[model samples]
Target: MPAPERIPPGRVSSVDLLAKGELTVRGRVREASNAVLYCSVSYEGEQAHCVYKPVAGERPLWDFPDGTLAQREVAAYELSEATGWGLVPPTVLRDGPYGQGMVQLWIEADPSESLLALVEDEEPGEGWKAVGFAEVGEGRTALLVHADDVRLRRLAVLDAVINNGDRKGGHLLPTADGNLYAIDHGVTFNVDDKLRTLLWGWAGEPLPADASRTLTELAATLTEGAPLATRLAELLTSAEVEALRGRVGVLLGAGVHPLPSGEWPAIPWPPV
Candidate 1:
């Protein structure tokens, strides 16, 4: 088998890292049922601890094709880089453990922060935006949460841009560096109106100026024959890519955050 791909440790595009690197499987991530492994990669005297998800181990989904989730994860990283938000840690796809899989730099997060509790605050605290409330059975206190942190706000916009179908709370991690990383994007970029997420806190609100600019840039990147378009062509279906572009245009035109269309459930189950 061709050796695993690797890249410079800290400062390269996901494309660069994924395109080059020698991968070595270190161990398995026992917490997951679908095989996830810990890996180490190195190239050019640079090394990184990474997570690798081999295509051979992915569980089949009725709604999504088999062996394609790894590619979607890479696509999400690519989109994150295109937006210049640095919200997704560098990710790439290459040969690994069992076969070709998605590989990404492992971000260690602060143990101090609990995004769930932060959002569950009853009051709309500073730096937070409350979405709504849910009842717990009959007499139990209703559950409430507000998506807090400007980083989450950015992710909300990105989720919309990708037509992300799963943005569960556990997918978010607050790094020790104080930066937030959004992970587990294997189910994103569907060619449908499926932006279910836990980030509806800013629903219908105006987009942040910078977020709008990023969307505009992304639209340009999706134009025919653009670099991003070319890369995406390798991973996503043509229809899905077109849908991504259309969604960007829609967001730009609306100039505000989107509200649930009610065509599907707006949130994922077991939110955190």
Candidate 2:
């Protein structure tokens, strides 16, 4: 395994300084027990929108400190870039008088057409039912009916290999054109049993053809001599890479409809 890519550190420009006067506040995007996310109009002309995440004031149930959380978020973005998956884009981590926060690319919110909305509009079929998760609203089920979709399923597998603990329904955004995008990957790459998530509801199922191909390509990209492999090695240890490889092998062996276990929580709360 090679070293993971290093993200450059910098301070985000002061929002207060930028917003001299008459800056209208956009509607709140999300507010949860751990963090509050807001969309705001930028003072500068270059960027129109920015997403803000304030520091967690109280001690969290999870073990990550503020700095570690910020670093993980940055690392996840870098990995997403390397993998060509729109999991999360580049973000600016900032520390100010208010405390720590992250300024990321603002995703345009559609007219309540997210994946969660789609699930809420339909009834759960034979293999679907709502799980006790915050993001799964009323009438929404967590089961993956199109589990056979190779691209989507493979992305899920990659997520699992990364030990992403937050794969909530809300984090999965469906574009107007029907492409799915993943967001909020703060609780990942930890060396612990904290691999909780809502995906893998269909474990042991056969991998879709396209998913297998993507995984194969991803594995090749992570080989010893590859740039991606070198980048990952810097960010992760040899043991972590071995674990990731093991997860990939398991997913490749499993098909598209394996059952999920009930031991772990369906998703990570306060998704950062």
Candidate 3:
């Protein structure tokens, strides 16, 4: 498949506008386990309403260290930017209403369209595939689906490179303009193999040429003496960064989509 067209970055300066922006809490998103609040962030006469997750409000997890998820979110954005895929929303770590944490641009999605419903449709839409089935009640069922869009396929490759451990269906947001913004990347960049996603639709398929080239470039940038690696060091441990570099090498060697290891889950719980 041809490479997804690379969207040129705007004439605007490359600034962490949201991070430096004045943030005010509009309301809390009760659905999140941690304190994720919706807020209006204003900076340099520009204003945007976005999600804010304060480090002080973070709920501890045994698998991940405390006060680090916020940093991991930023790290995810950094990796996304380096990939030039524009798959993740603009995110940064900054001091917010409560304390220091993550702030991300809010994606405006078509609420009328639901991924769950589309996946469970008796006849699935074009460019989409059913990965597995979900048991509802006796004899009742639902299907888990993922898009075949090149951007999404690239994102699946990106998830593997970052060791993303939790990629739930609800984390995908399709904007009104057909852009897909992936969010909630707090559990990422582990030194171990923790990839858990719902994007195995193309498993075992050869990695597209464009995807392979991009991964190759990313692998180069992640090596010692590279600027991207320097930036990653500030967000992740040395070991974790090395692990990321290792995954890049592994992906380059495999040259094909990965299948479930069966040692760990291939999908997230509460998939949607």
RMSD of each: 4.0, 8.8, 5.2
For residues 1-272, write the lDDT of model 2, one tens digit per residue.
11212222334343332232122335445444445455444333323454455555323644554445544555566556655665564555565324665555555444455233124334444434333333456765443332333445645665766777677656665555555656666666766535655554446556667667766677777667688767666556666556666666655666453344455664555432
The 0-to-1 C-alpha lDDT of every candidate, in the order given, reads 0.81, 0.52, 0.81
Model 2 error, position 25 (Å): 9.9
Q: Sort by TM-score, best first: what order? A: 3, 1, 2
Runs in model 1 lying further than 4 Å from the true structure:
1-19, 118-122, 134-139
TM-score-better candidate, 1 vs 2: 1
- Candidate 3 residue-wise lDDT, 201-222, digit = tens: 8788899999999999998899
Q: Model 2 TM-score?
A: 0.62
**Residue 198 CA error for candidate 3 (Å)?**
1.1
- For TM-score, the strongest prediction is 3
List runs of model 3 lying over 4 Å from the truth: 1-15, 112-126
Q: What's the true lDDT of residue 44 in model 1?
A: 61
lDDT of 1 by residue, 69-94 (tens): 98998899889989888889788888
